[model samples]
Each structure stands twice: as structure tokens, then as C-alpha cells.
Target: MHVPDGFINAPVSAAAGVVAAGAVAVSLRGARKELDERTAPLAGLVAAFVFAVQMLNFPVAAGTSGHLLGGALAAILVGPYTGVLCIAVVLLMQGVLFADGGLTALGVNITDMAVVTVVVAYALFRGLVLVLPRKRGSVTVASFVAALVSVPAAAIAFTAIYAIGGTTDVPLGKVFTAMAGVHVLIGIGEAVITMLTVGAVIAVRPDLVHGARGLSAPLKLRVNGELVDAAPAAAPAATPVAARSPKKIWISGVVTALLLAGFVSFYASASPDGLEKVAADQGIDAKAEPHAAADSPLADYGVKDISDARLSGGLAGVIGVGATLAVGSGAFWAVRRRRHTDAGARA
Candidate 1:
């Protein structure tokens, strides 16, 4: 849910900005350890994928729709720290280029959508994976549950933030109920999307999926007082096959993302999202401010002066994907480079 400007007062928004900045700083440091040659490039692709999927809003209720919040999917595919950066990059691109999320409320959006969701979802995912059977299916199940919970968690977070800095006089209890209720439905959509995407990645390149790393290569077990490998004897012969280059998957994923955004997005439900529906119903948006980039060529996910709805939206989506990929890849590359440099200095 992208909080627009004026929904929260200046003081609280500024505080959120500080919190968002701090979280990003922390994530960047943590991501140094999370990203390597293999995963760093994939992080950018993850961001672009998230951006693309978010545009395909599925209807949740009569007048409400929801899209992928993407915290769980990103964290499961990459690392939690890198997931935060991926989402943050998408939010930045949406705010500045697409004029979708509010510029002034960017911090609040990031805190609720990126920081809170990633932390909660990843923690739950890790916890479940530990207790469940160590298999690919377990990862998929954990992803579904984590993503299901993360949406409401984010809704609760937004309610908390609104309680502190709400611009309207709406009853806090009603706001909480409405926000949570609608978001719960939205959570189902998020869970489904996250599960499908996570499952797809795990099937192709489990190695690239940070959460699925050890699941494919089963651990040895001691049977009848003797230690034995869990895998069958012939399994060792498949090493070369499984060791295929990631380039194919990477390119295919990017192409799929482009297709989803540039073409498939045209048919997405047009209903207002969970947050927007709640804001309108609860009067939370009574004082909502116009976006600063309202006149931008790509405002409202359409190219300016483009008469064809399909062409306008398609062009905007493509631009968004391209921009998110560039920014996200550049940021991750920098982090990866710094990590190598630091390692060298230590050595």
C-alpha cells in the first residue's frame, strides 16, 4: 500500500523518514554479507520482477484490489537484507518516475512496505523452515504462510503509524479494523503470488534462491549406528546437470518480468487497492495532497499525451521496469564491490 502525501503529518512523516534512512543504512551493511557474485545480479532482477508483479493488481473484494507486496517473495528468492533494498528501489522508482507513491510519504511507505514486511516475513519464513520437513515443498509452504501473514502485519504497521501521525480525526479503532480486514483478503493474493514465484525459482535454480539453498542437497543421516548419505548413490551423477549456468534463468526471468509489466498489466483489475479503499472509506485521505509529480509524463502509470490506453500504460510499465533494474543493479553492484574491497583489506 503506497501511502500518499498528507495522509500523515509532517512531524511524523519526518520521523518515519529518519527511521527509513536508518533501516536502509543497516540493510546496506547487512547486504554486504548477503550478496556475492552469484546473488548480487539476481537481486536486481528480483527488484524488477517485484515492480512488474505489483502492477498486476488482482481484485480482492467488490471494490478493493491487491497486488504483490513482495517482501516474502524477494526475501525467499534473495536475502532479507537485499530484499529490503530491492523493494526500496521499486518504491523510489514509482515515486520519482511513475508518480505512483507519494514523494513526501516515501519514508512511511518504505518503512511499512519494505522494512516491516521484510523483517516479519523473513523471520517467520526462517522459523517455519526450521520446523518443517527439509524439502522444496516445505519452502513453498513456508513462503505462502509468511507472505499471508506479512500483508496484515504491514497493515497493522500502517495503522500504528497512522495512530501516531494521522491527518484526520477518524476513530483509531475503526481505522484499524477496516485496514486489517481488507488487508487480510489482500494477504491471500500476496500469498498466492509469492508462493508461485518462489516455487518457480526454486524449481529452476534453487541455488539462486537464498532460502532454498540447502534444501536441494539433503543432509546425511546416521542409520543403524552408521552415517550414510541421504541421497541415493546415483544422485551424485546429476551434479553436472544441476550445475547449469544461471544466465538462462536470469534472462528468462527478466523477459517474463518485461512481459508481465509491458503487456499483461493491461488487464489487471482497476479497483483501488486495500490501502486506498480503506483510506477512502475511513476518511483517512480527506486531506490527501496531490503528488508533486502529478504532471510528470508517466504519472498514474500512463505516458502523457498517449491516446492509446494500452500503449501508454505499456510504455510506462516498461520504463518503470528498466529504471528499477538499472538503479537496483547499480546499488547492488556497489555493495558487492565494497564487500570484495573490504575482504581484500582484511586479507
Candidate 2:
């Protein structure tokens, strides 16, 4: 959920900002090992795709809706550290460009949505992968479960944060109950989206999916009543024809993101999302302030002075996707370059 300004007091918000900054710093360092020539650009595409899918909010309850949080999906596709950065990029774009989230509460949104979700989802996913059968399907199953849990975990985290620095005097129990209850329903949507996305990627290019890697257990030979690891397979003379290029996947992803955001988003439910509904019902927005970028041309996912709702929203969505891709790609490319620089220095 994107926390808006004035929901949390200044001191607590500032503290959360520090925490968010520290987490981003740590993720940048960790991402060095995760990013490389092939996956770095793919990570950017993942971020843009998450940005697009988040626009298509599905109805959860009569008046409540939910959307993909993307932590589990990103983590399963790429890596955990990179997943956090992906979400951070999306949140930043939404806040500054679309005014979907508040600028003042950026830290709260990043900490709760980006850091907490990624950390919880990836940890649970890895744990489940270890216990389950090491198969491609197992990764999808683990992704579903991990995404399901991460939503409520983020809700709990928000509730805890509100208990400490809530602007209003709403009862802690009521806030917790409402947030947890609605988010659980929302979690199912998150799980399904995560499962389908991860499954699709695994089916096409399992090597590109970080969590699906090593799914095919190494061959072992039984010799003298003991099983020993078989000799490694030799490299082929040419790449297999079935193997898809990263460029193809990248282009396909961009097209899918554009379609989802540009047109499909128009059909998405217009109802408020889980957090907005809960906030309105629970009085969490009593002190909510207006977004700083409310007057931006692209604010509210619409182009300024555009009378046609469909065209305005479509153009805004396209712009958002393009901007997210550029910013995310630049950030990841820098991380990749830094990694190479470090290696060269060591050499």
C-alpha cells in the first residue's frame, strides 16, 4: 500500500526515511553480485512490468480492489536484492510522476512496500523451495505462497508503524484487524499474479528466472553400490535453436507492459484499493495531506488538459512505462558497471 503524507507523524516518518535509505544502500551493494551483462537490463524490464501491472487493479471485495505488489514476482524472476530495487524504482516513479503515492511519505511506502515485501517474500520462497520437490512447478508454487504471505506481512508492518506514529487516535486493534483482513483477500490476487508470471517465465526461459535455476537436479551414476555425480556435459558446438535471446524476451515484455498499461488498464476496477478503502473506513486518512505533485501533467495517471479519459490515461501509462524503463535500466547498468570496475581493480 502506498502510504500518503500526514498519516504518520514527522519524527516517525523521518526515522522510516533513514531506514529506507539504509536498506537501499545495502541493496545496491548486494545487487552488484546479482546483476551482470545479461540480467541487468532484464531487471529493468521487470521493474517496468511491475509498474504496468500495478495499474490493473482487480476487485477484491464489493468496494475494494487489489493489484500486484510485484515483490515475489520480481524476486522469483530476478533476485531479492534486485527485486527490492525494482519496487523502489516503481514507487519512486509513481510518487513523483503519477502522484499515486505521496512524496513526503516516500520512505514509508518504500520501507513497507519495497523492503518488507521483498525481504519476507524471498525468505519464505527460498525456505519453501528447499523443502519442496526441486522442480519447475515447485518454484511457481513457492512463488504463490510467498506472494500470498508478503501482502499481509506488509499490512502487519504498516499496522505496527501506525501504532508507533499514527496521526489519528484510531484504536490499534481496529487498524490491525481491518488492515490484516482486507489485505489477506488482496494477497490471493498477489499470489495468482505472481504464480502466473513466474510460471510463464520459467516455461520460456528458466535460466533467466533466478529462483528456477538449478531445478534440474544433476545426473548421478550408480557405481559399486554408491551413487556418484556424473561427469559434466560438454558444451555444444552451437546454441540450441529453442533457446530464446534476451532481446526477444525484452521486446516481448515491453509490448506486454504497454498493452497492459495502455489499454487493459482502462478496464480495471475503478474502486479504491485495499489500503485506500481501509484508510477511509478506519479514519487513517483524517490527516492525509494532498500529494505534492497533484498538479503535475501526468498526475492521477492522466495527461493534463486531455478531455478523452481513455487517451489521457493511455498516454500517461505509456509515459510511465517508458520513464520507469529508462531510469531502472540506467540504475541497474550503473550497478553492473560498478561490479566490473571492482573486479578489474582486484585483477
Distance from true location, Cα of 139 in model 1, Å: 0.3
What's the C-alpha lDDT at position 235 in model 1? 41
Q: Write the per-residue lDDT of candidate 2 for residues 1-347, one digit (tens) a residue.
A: 88999899999999999999999999999999999888998999999999999999999999999998898888878899999999999999999999988888889999999999999999999999999998999999999999999999999999999999999999999999999999999999999999998888888888899888777887889999999999989966887654546888899999999999999999999999998999999899999999999999999999999999999999999999999999999999999999999999999
- Give candidate 1 misplaced runs (Cα > 4 Å): 216-243
Candidate 1 residues 148-214, lDDT tens each? 9999999999999999999999999999999999999999999999999889988887878898876
| Best candidate (score: TM-score) | 2
Which residue pairs collide, candidate 1?
none
Roughly what TM-score does model 1 have, to 2 decimal places? 0.95
TM-score for every candidate vs. truth? Answer: 0.95, 0.97
The total of clashing pairs for model 2 equals 0
